[model samples]
Target: MTTLQVEGLTKVFGRGAGRTVAVQPMDLEIDTSTALGIVGESGSGKSTLARLLVGFETPTAGAIHLDGRPISRMLSMPRERREFRRAVQFVAQDTFSAFDPRRTLRDAVATPLRVLREVTGPAADAEIRDVLGLLQLDPALLDRYPSQVSGGQRQRFALARSLVVRPQILLCDEVVSALDVSVQGAVLNMIRDYCETYRVGLGFISHGLPATTFIADTLLVMRHGAVVETGPTEQVVDRPEHPYTRTLLDAYRRGPRRVVAVDPVA
Candidate 1:
C-alpha cells in the first residue's frame, strides 16, 4: 500500500558557481492512508520536495511515483494531468493569498466541485455545509468573506476547500503554523479524523517537528537540502540518528524533566 514513492529526487536552482541546491537526491515512501511528516529547519528543502511531489515544481533530476506511475511520465498527457491535479492537493501557508480576494469562502471552496462536475443541484448547499461541518466550521459562516473570519477559520476554510475535492493525497505545508496552540490542536485532530474517515494519505511539511509528531506515522528529517534521517515516527522521535534531527527535537523540548530525554543539540 505504498501510495507515493520518491526515489533519487533532486531539485536545484540557478546554475554554475552561483547555483543553489534546493533538494539533494533523496528517496522516501509514504504508505496509503497514513501520515508522513517532513521535518526540517528553514531552507532545508522540505518545501521544495513537497512542491515537486505535488507537481507544483518539476524536479531537477530523479523520480517520484504516485501509486506506481512516475510523476514526470504522468504529466505528459492532458487527461492524466487533470486527474493528477485532482488526486493530489496542497494547503498553502498563507490562507489569504491562496484564494481570490473577490470570491467569498463559499465560492472558493465550491470552485473545485463546479470544475470537476462532481456536485450539482440544490444538494450542493448541503455538500458545502457537510464539508464545513467536518472542519468544525459553522455552516452559517460559509457565505462570509475570508477577511471576516479568524485566522483559524481562514485556515480551516482553506482546508475545507482542499478536502471538498476529496483528493487521495493531501500535501499540507505548515498548515497550522500560524495558528495558536489550541487552534493547531483542533485542526490537527480534524485532519486525523478526516484521514481516518476517508482512508486518504497525508504529507505534512513543517519546520516545527513537535507539531507534527502527534499525527505522523513516519518521519523524514531534512537538512541542507538533503535527507538527514528517516524512520518510524516513534523511533525517529525517541532515537533520532542525525544531528539535524536531534536539533529539531531539542528545539521542541521543554527542558528540566523533559518528556523525552533527547540531546539539546547535535
Candidate 2:
C-alpha cells in the first residue's frame, strides 16, 4: 500500500524575483512498512519536505496524500485534522531541545496519550514500558530529565515518545546526527527493528549517505530545492546518476586522498 504520495509539491518563500524556492514540484512515494531516505546538503529543502509531510508548514503549491487522501484539502473539518495528526508524527533532529527541561522522560512521552485519552493509570504505564522496551531504552531511566541523559538516550526517548502515539508514519529529521558513531548505529538499528515489527513507515532525512545506506530501501537525493535523483538505495549509492549525487557520495568517502602526488624518488 502507498503510505504517502507527494506530487508537484512546491514551497516558496518571499515574492516576485526574490523568491526562494525551498522545494520545487517534487514527486515521491513511500510504501507501507518500508524506509525511504532523503539526503541533501544544508539548504537543499529536505527538512522543508518533511515539515510539509507532517502539516507543520503549509506548502505554497501542490498536494500531499496520506493513505490516498489529500491532507492539504481537509482543512474544513477539525476531526479530520486531529486524525491526520494522529496518523503521522515527527522526530526532530535534536531531541533534547524538543523536550521540556523540567519534565521527566516518562511524563514527556506520555503527554500525547494523555491528551488523546488513549490510556490511563495502569494502561499508561504499560504503554510507556512497551514503547521504551521496543526502543531498547532501560526502564530505570524513565525518571531522568532530558538534560541528564546522553544524546543516544535522548534520541531513543524521542523515538519512544513518537511510537507511544501509534503513528502509521514517522518523519525522522536527522534524529541520530548528534550521537556518537557507535551509539548512532545502535539507535538506528532499533528504529529499523521497530518499523519492521510495527509495520510503521519511516522517512529518514539526513546528509549522512553511509548511515542512510544501511537502513533505507529507497534513496532520494535533493539539490537546490529539487530532487536530483532517486532509486534503490544500493543502486544510488553504488551508481549515482546525477552530478550532485556523485558529489554527495564523493564527499562521504572515507580517508584522505593524494590530492597532489609526485614520484617519491624524483
Candidate 3:
C-alpha cells in the first residue's frame, strides 16, 4: 500500500528576534484509503503544513517520504517530479482564483493532462467527462468559464481538475470554508465519496471541527504550530485529552451550528 510519511517536518521564517516558527517539527503518516484531518484555528500552521506536503513550499528541517522514497529527491529530477505531481495533488480553498477566469472549465481540467502528456484527443475528453461526472457536475458546465459558474460549482470543478490527474493522495486546505453551509455539506459528501471510491489518501486541513469530523477517520489537532492531540476522530472529538482539544470541542458544541472556533472557556 502507498504511504506518505513526514518526519521532523519544520518550517521557520526570519532570523533572531524576528524569527517565527510557522510549523514546528512534526511527524505524520497517511496510507491509502484513509483520511486524516488537521484542524486548528487561524495561525495554527495547518495551511503551512499542507503547502509543505504538496511541494508548494520546501521544508526547513525534515524529510517527506513516499513509500520509503524521499520526496525531496523525487522533486529534484524532472521525470520524478512529474511522477510526484501525479501521485499527490492539492486542492486550495480559493477555487475561483485557482482557475483562469478566461479559460473554460474543460480547458482548465485538461491542462494537467497536456502538461503531463498523459492523454489526448478523444481519450482526454472522455477522461475529463468521466471525472466531472463523478463529482455530479453537469457536462454543460464544462464549456463555461470560471466566472460563469457559482462558487460551489467552481469548487467542484476544481476537484474535478485534480481527480482528472488520477492522483493517489489528495491534499485539501480549507476547501469548503468559502461555500454556503448547504453547499459545504454537499461538497464534503462528494469529497468523502470520491476518496473512498478512488482509495486515495486524504490530508484534509481545515479550521472547522464539524467538517473534519464528518470527513476524517483520524484527527490531528494543532495549536500555535504544535500538535496538541492526535488520535481517532471519535476519541479526539468525544473524549479529548488535551485542554486545547476540549476547548475546540466545547466551542463547536456551544457556538453557531456552522462555525468551528475555539471556546474562550472549556
Q: What lDDT score is found at residue 22 in candidate 1?
A: 95
**Relative to the true structure, how large is the alpha-carbon lDDT of every model?**
0.81, 0.82, 0.87
Q: How close is every model to the real structure, measured as TM-score?
A: 0.91, 0.91, 0.94
After superposing candidate 1, which stretches have Cα over 4 Å from the reference?
255-266
Q: Residue 173 of model 3: what lDDT?
A: 95
Candidate 1 local lDDT, 1-266, one digit each (tens): 44778889999899999899999989887655679988888899988888899888899899999888997877888777767777888898889899887888888888887675468666777787888877878877778888898998999889988888888888899998898777877788888779878888889998877667877888988889988888889899889888777877887776321212211110
Error of 1 at 192 (Å): 1.0
Rank the candidate models, highest lDDT first. Answer: 3, 2, 1
Preferred candidate (TM-score higher): 1 or 2? 1
Model 2, span 1-266: residue lDDT tens = 54788889999999999999999998888666579999999899999999998888898999998878898765446777767767788999877579999999889988887765467788999999988776667888889899988877888888888888888888899887787666777777877777888788889999788678777899999988999999998899789899989888888776222122111110
1-266, model 3: which lDDT tens digit per residue? 78889999999988999998999999999888779999999999999999899888899999999889899999999998898898889999987679998889889989998776579789999988898777778889989899998888888889988888888899999998988777787788878888998799999999998888888999999999999899999888789999999989998887554433221110
Candidate 3 to truth, TM: 0.94
Against the true structure, candidate 1 reaches a TM-score of 0.91
Candidate 3 structure lDDT:
0.87
Clashes (candidate 3): 0
lDDT of 3 at 133: 70
